[model samples]
Target: MKTRIATAVLAAALLTACARDPQPASLPPAPSATSTATSTAVAEPCASVITRMSERERLAQLLVVGVDPADPDAAVRLVREQQVGGVFIGGNATALLRNNALDAVQHAARWGVSIAVDEEGGRVQRIDELDGTLPSARTMARTKTVDQVRAAGRERGAQLRARGVTVDFAPSLDVSSQPDDGPIGDRSFSSDPAVVRAYGLAFAAGLRDAGITPVFKHFPGHGHAEGDSHAGQVTTPALASLRTVDLVPYQDVAGFDGGAVMVGHLTVPGLTDGVPASLSPAAYRLLREDYHFTGPVLTDDLGAMKAITGTYRLPDAVLHALLAGADQALWSSGGNVSAVLDRLQQAVDSGELPATRVTDALGRILPAKHACG
Candidate 1:
């Protein structure tokens, strides 16, 4: 009986040892140092890719041309030929169209291109058919709390990101003092600069949290402007007025890290001798010097916007935008993209547009691309 007890005890000890030894399936293997290093090595290519890009390729990286969702083939062609840095999904963007366009563009380009959309919620939203609409900017400002606005931004960003969109041209910081203002009426968050500043920051933060980039629009204040830039040149209030009211929100968000600002087409007579801010060196100077914004500065659409096209053709307007310190010259109509590329390359070759300008633009752009990725 003692011998039998000893054998039973030994069996129990064996059972305990088995229980102490965890099954392989229960514990995930820790990543080895070599594997971790390999994963990091894979991500280092974008830097080298940027370094090896030719001058023309570098210039192309500054262009974010629009693409019609109906014409996916054309977008593919544009990516293959023009080597544009990004494509903004334009015109009635349904889920199918957005997915198709993304697939085509992503397949064509050797490097990934930033696929962006105007999903600013409310009336400015471009992909509402695929992603349901949120309240207008004015409505949200009047009714929604800062947290509510931020949550809306996250929802908007998730919808876009789900369809492979990376950038959101949104959260207009223009403070609409005049509710009846023709261009920015319903689009502006509030007449109060503080409200606008708070909501804008919240909305931007939400987009960043969702892994999407947000671009603040109509810099130096389009809220006070008289007319729509798409129709014709609009004029903003004097610089003093802008400083007090219009420029306040921008100054508040100027230090934003992962955000970009879109210079408007308004003719700021006070700051820039009646030059549209998008093409005016003085306007850009105010943003860069006074506001201390070092992030990417994009121009409002250069294509067919009477504010620019009325004065300069597509190619010339692109050149002016680049010369004026705009990083990405957006043509939202999907015009002859190759022609614009050819013209930019020619300008670079002729020394009309300095290569340093391209490099400077890339300095702002590539980091944003890497961040979004």
Candidate 2:
């Protein structure tokens, strides 16, 4: 274990030394799908906002809390007082309910907060009634052309944007090689890596065309995992297989300017020391060094997932995530966000966690928020 950690730390240092800032590039064109929004100008530079914020406020910006429709007041408090950076709408939040809640939260926030939803279509659809449904990713890959998939993405994005959603966590990039795989299965585009890449890019392109930021998810692949991360920590394929097969889509999408990536909770034996990727600095190092992803890296739900809660509770899990290199820690189960924010402030004050980590995280997160506007 000591040797492995040393090797991982060395690899990260080397990757950092060799890393170059990525040149901004336009998304590759699909048949009829062109990006509606360009990176011409950010309305408010994230750097400016970071300079003006207090340490606690800056830390708040790195948290994406899950809002429940049942407790609208608590959700509003999270945004208004805690100054949470974003909200993920789920748990009985229909379109109307979600929109109403978002309106209230936005009204409470001093700055624009990202409104995200898991609108992947098919089974993972969060707001089916409001956004409507398309088709499963597998079915879309099998039956539709790449252009058609792009069109579907545009259509979905339009619905989400209309309802005030800025981020759509769709276009699963995990190569579903095994049909009977526990978590991914039909959520994936195809068993073939090439097919998954083509369709995933198309779907992401469509989302970008509609002015919704597309977040490609389950980084380093989840298709081959034997168990679900939501239930407990699941082991994944070795690094070689992940780089060649699962990580290809992420590497391909790195050139596009308007996309984010969500790291999952699976434990990679050789890479993360059996810790879930969301809380593994080694896993994040791989994403930064191996994949060259510069955009915001969000965690899968932090509160409900047993992989996290079964081990560390709220504020501890949140701290580990930030320390592990995630730009945003997503807590989908409702709780007093202020408590977590306070703990983060204390950690930073006592030299337990560096202030630069908060600033660096905000540097990545604020730009995404700016892009949403």
lDDT score, residue 45, model 1?
Answer: 41
> In candidate 1, what are the lDDT values of residues 1-373, reduced to their tens digit?
0001122332343234223322233221211111110011123445566677887788889899876565667778888887888887655535335544577677777666778776665556666666577777788888989999999888888777777788888888888865533467777788999999999888988888898989988888888788877788889888988999988898766678789988989888677677788887778878877888877889887764677766676776777778877888987666556677788889878877777677667767777877224
Clashes of each: 0, 0
Across residues 1-373, which tens digit of lDDT does each residue of candidate 2 receive? 0001122332333244213222224321111101111112223465666667888888888898766555567667778887888987664346324535567777788777888877776666755655566788898998999999999999889878877788988778988765533378778998888999999999999999999999888887887776776677778888877887877777787787899988888888688777788888877778877777777888887766677666765676778788778888986655547767877888788876677677777767777767223
What are the Cα lDDT values of the candidates?
0.73, 0.73
Name the runs in model 1 displaced over 4 angstroms.
1-47, 93-101, 178-181, 371-373
CA shift at 110, candidate 2, in angstroms? 1.3
TM-scores for candidates 1 onward, in order: 0.84, 0.84
Q: Where in model 2 is the C-alpha error above 4 Å?
A: 1-45, 70-73, 95-101, 371-373
RMSD of each: 22.2, 12.6
